[model samples]
Target: MIAQRYSYLSWLPLLLVSSSHPQWPSSWRCIPQPARSSVPCYCSGRQTWAGSLCGTLRIPGKRKRNEIMLRYVVALSLLALSWAQDCQVANINVMQNFDKTRYAGTWYAVGKKDPEGLFLLDNIVAQINIEEDGKMTATAQGRVIILNNWEMCAHMFATFEETADPAKFKMKYWGAASYLQTGNDDHWVIDTDYDNYAVHYSCRLVDADGTCLDGYSFIFSRHPTGLRPEDQLVVLQKKTDLCLLGKYRRVAHTGFCESGTSLDPQ
Candidate 1:
């Protein structure tokens, strides 16, 4: 098996030589076979390695074939990296010894990863309050489009139920108005500094592979303007840890909700 793996990586020398080329031919293609397939060969008629196989790649000529093989090698490397990420929702880590007292305050949504059928569009702000009994509840305001494209500021409320993990909570949320969205969600505090920024994640659906099928995330900041320059890198690393680095969009605040008549929860 080791010898076969070494033979497979022998193409790396050619890949290194071609790395300096300005452009690769777009006509090259590499289609890998299913992992469960019993295929006997790989690229260039080589035996399959690591229990995986590559399907026949189409190229116009010998030069294009070599370039395409280089791309195939890069694709394999990326696949390996993705597998190492371990995106299983149950395996994801959260903050340790979370303090709800310090977390209670106004948080502006600087960035968000919307789930399917996103309700909130922008100008999102959430206020967390801890009751006298040490229970956590929150209210949020955001601009949303309702029936027949009627845009309005949505006021939502949520109550958190404690769990075995301090950073993880079961959130029961509802809208101030009956027409808005309401449901239960898993609220996990991925990371936070309790003063500058906070990262929150929720998975509404789980796939068979133990990965998040449908989910949303929020990058919260104490200031509505945005995260501090020093906090940006830390938040970026937390986003990467959640496997949602590039899936977020900036949540803008243009005073849309502030101007509305909706009562802000106190």
Candidate 2:
């Protein structure tokens, strides 16, 4: 039976090469081997060709090809998504034609996204005032741990300089005490209803890719308790737009800095 099979297969090359089998690949040649041999017959190239003709021929079929194509498609899709969500700092939008008068007064920090080397921890509150010359100045109080483990209520003040965009300002801030954090930061009002909620953003460091490397955000509310139910949805949407949605932690108002005698920044 083995001899007969081999004899029958030995004519495969002549059959394949015949004009009657014009569809057969010219590169493929069937050279019959011993039945006990692992490769009884083969086609040329890296891929074992003519898989349908040779039952033992190991070749990548339609399913495997589809899998390879699918993998490429998935990788490209992920790369595109990453590009879409790059969160470029220059592309971030701030409030249009922001009214300074409407934005003044006390704002309670309801949610906060902290930056690297965060100073404020919780119980944050900000008081904004417009000076007689229409300059904006703010005073903020928050709980902070400095000198490694010494916790204290921080009294901070900031003076904002006008920029080309009304909603954007360059903030020069310093703590009342010498031990507190002090620096110049970019202040942008992302969104503000003035009467209810306001979103503030600051980027301390921008990466080479035009994305914010070190930044912070504050979700402020007119009320001390936090944003109202209806306003929560609006704030949530703003948080998502800022790309700092899940990065925020609730800012508690435990009155840690409220009762403390805050020193006036000279």
Candidate 3:
């Protein structure tokens, strides 16, 4: 299979922290997907948006960063499971129509928060590839909260629809079943059109077999970048997806940019 690489995030001091439009369940808390992040965002932990940053708290960092992160965000990692899990988790398939190829690319970290605790992959990047093997390979670079600052690189594998319709496919990247409960049942993708340049990822509260419950969803687009601001006010409305705008953010800048002045930026 052919492969390509892209550019790194230019260090930019933020003007302000960006928040998301998420409908959080009372029982679930939001957490940053990445291990290190500046601002806290709301997410279910099990399912990540299309192009947003995502990482669980794997290693404890400085006492300060740990305390600060836990105050505002949920803990889904091994370090912080004792405080939550008071309710039952729902199960469902949420990706029946979402497209796959359109979802490939680099996405930046916007926001995240979960019960497992707060995690943000600061200076983060997600590189997803649909290889000949049909399995998705994810390469990510970000910082883990440590005594100083731990910049980490992680490689993860996700399995996609083997029996799913190619037209509308689904993908499962991670998270344990318990963490996924009370969220989307099974992370489904009900609709997607590769040539159409648009589609979404969906999840449910139940599984096909009914053995487990915990679902999530993440929508994607054929185009890399998100809908333009002017388009949102007029012709282009902010389309909805499982991951919301997170999936589309930085999509144009992922694993391999569609076209550019330089594919490898040093």
Clashing pairs in 1: none
Best by lDDT: 1
Candidate 3: which stretches are off by over 4 Å? 1-96, 115-118, 147-157, 161-227, 230-266
CA lDDT of every candidate: 0.79, 0.77, 0.34
TM-score for each candidate, following the candidate numbering? 0.71, 0.67, 0.32
**Deviation in Å, model 1, residue 112 alpha carbon:** 0.6
TM-score of 2: 0.67
Rate residue 195 of model 2 by lDDT. Answer: 98
Candidate 2 lDDT over residue span 71-142, tens digit each: 767989967865677488998889998999999999999899998874888888899999999999999988
Off by over 4 Å in 2: 1-83, 261-266
The model with the greater TM-score, 2 or 3, is: 2
- The better-scoring model by TM-score among 1 and 3 is 1
* lDDT (C-alpha) at residue 191 in model 1: 90
Candidate 3 has its poorest 10 consecutive residues by lDDT at 9-18
Clashes of 3: 69
